[model samples]
Target: MAGHKIPHFQNDAGHSAIEIGVKEFMCVGANPPFDHPHEFLDMGAETEKVCPYCSTLYKFNPALAETETVPAGCTLTTEAA
Candidate 1:
């Protein structure tokens, strides 16, 4: 997992819950400039998890791509090293 490109998402739209494909990902409260600390979340054996930083709930969706989100615009294109 050293070179894995972990999917990162942001909730700029302030959605109460977001549907994502990947069970493991990073939740950035909002887009940079207003974003909270990027928190890595994993939903192992579960369908959903909540971000403690933003209190945003994330639901797993098998129908979506690993880098996709239900409402869209939640996937962060640019990532930091």
Candidate 2:
């Protein structure tokens, strides 16, 4: 993201996955006191989305098991990892 101050959701592997069914979400660079304008993000068939306002990139992973945010390859989200 531009300026690198833009905040994004990330797993322990530094790769973040958007959960299924939660297609629409809000993108804010920071919280409360330092928050930017709330940008609405739509996760379509594409795997990645970027917020125009904050330049934050949001990724959708089909392998997230429908109930998780982290990818299947993520160690932090699985027991067998």
Candidate 3:
């Protein structure tokens, strides 16, 4: 054989790993008590947005800061590192 190519396979040998890091994320939304006269004129005004997963009410002030992480055996920890 001129050259042997090694075939790659996925295994669980290195599945368990841990990663620790910090990130800053900002969430913004349309101003509540909206500044626009047209919006205020509307009787049914929905001013706030919510997070689908956490159901956090989106706001304009102080934004939102959070520490997010994945478990030791999570695939994200392995791929994102």
Candidate 4:
């Protein structure tokens, strides 16, 4: 009896799978969409500071004592914290 050699399989699905894995494994941290700020600034608001990178709002209180400069273009308004 003689053994037959099988050829390697090639398909678009395999290429797509490899591409997706590479993209997912890539270190694309803080690249886009979820832009993380390097420095946090306190706007002196009642208890919240707006993130400049992602434009997401954050809150700080007197208990934490975490003071940071508020980003530019943000208004400081005092409220009960």
Candidate 5:
């Protein structure tokens, strides 16, 4: 059996909802063609924050173990703009 790898960054599809670690990352406005600029957001402080551009909801799930990666319903599909 093999262990799944966790990527440093991913797209908005699987990123719509997430539970992140202490690392700092950015959020882009749109999905692809209509995407906007990237804005860095910190998850260490709040439980959730909405993207000003795309209006997607982002959440922090503290229940997940550090060894775990992306949340359920997420695919690690795309990257930032």
Candidate 6:
């Protein structure tokens, strides 16, 4: 994730689980200000993982793009400094 754009996602809808396209990404808990610490998560050989801070389960979906997330609009488009 160091020289690349590791997709950042948020659980704005407060969904219990989210289906994501990539196996590696970041969970921001929610939007800025109120958002928790940005955490990097990897599923490795698994299909799902839960964010340690937010406890939001992320399921892998091969059909979706790296920037895509189920329920839509969950992908944080702007980069955090």
Clashes of each: 0, 0, 0, 5, 1, 0
Model 5 reaches what TM-score against the true structure?
A: 0.47
Off by over 4 Å in 2: 1-21, 65-81
Root mean square deviation (Cα) for candidate 3: 21.1
Q: Name every residue pair that clashes in candidate 2.
A: none
- True-structure lDDT of candidate 1: 0.87
CA RMSD, predictions in order: 1.9, 11.3, 21.1, 25.1, 7.4, 2.2
Task: Report residue 34 deviation for candidate 1 (angstroms).
Answer: 2.1
Query: Candidate 4 vs candidate 5: which has greater TM-score?
Result: 5
Cand. 1 TM to true fold: 0.88
lDDT of 5 by residue, 1-81 (tens): 125333233344635655554234455543567556765555556777666666655665556543333554332333332
Model 6, C-alpha of 49: deviation from truth (Å): 0.3
| Top-down lDDT ranking | 6, 1, 5, 2, 4, 3
Quote each prediction's TM-score. 0.88, 0.46, 0.19, 0.28, 0.47, 0.88
Model 2 clashes, total count:
0
State candidate 2's TM-score.
0.46
Looking at model 4, residue 78 earns an lDDT score of 21
Regions of model 6 farther than 4 Å from truth: 78-81
RMSD of candidate 5 to true structure, Å = 7.4
Clashes of 1: 0
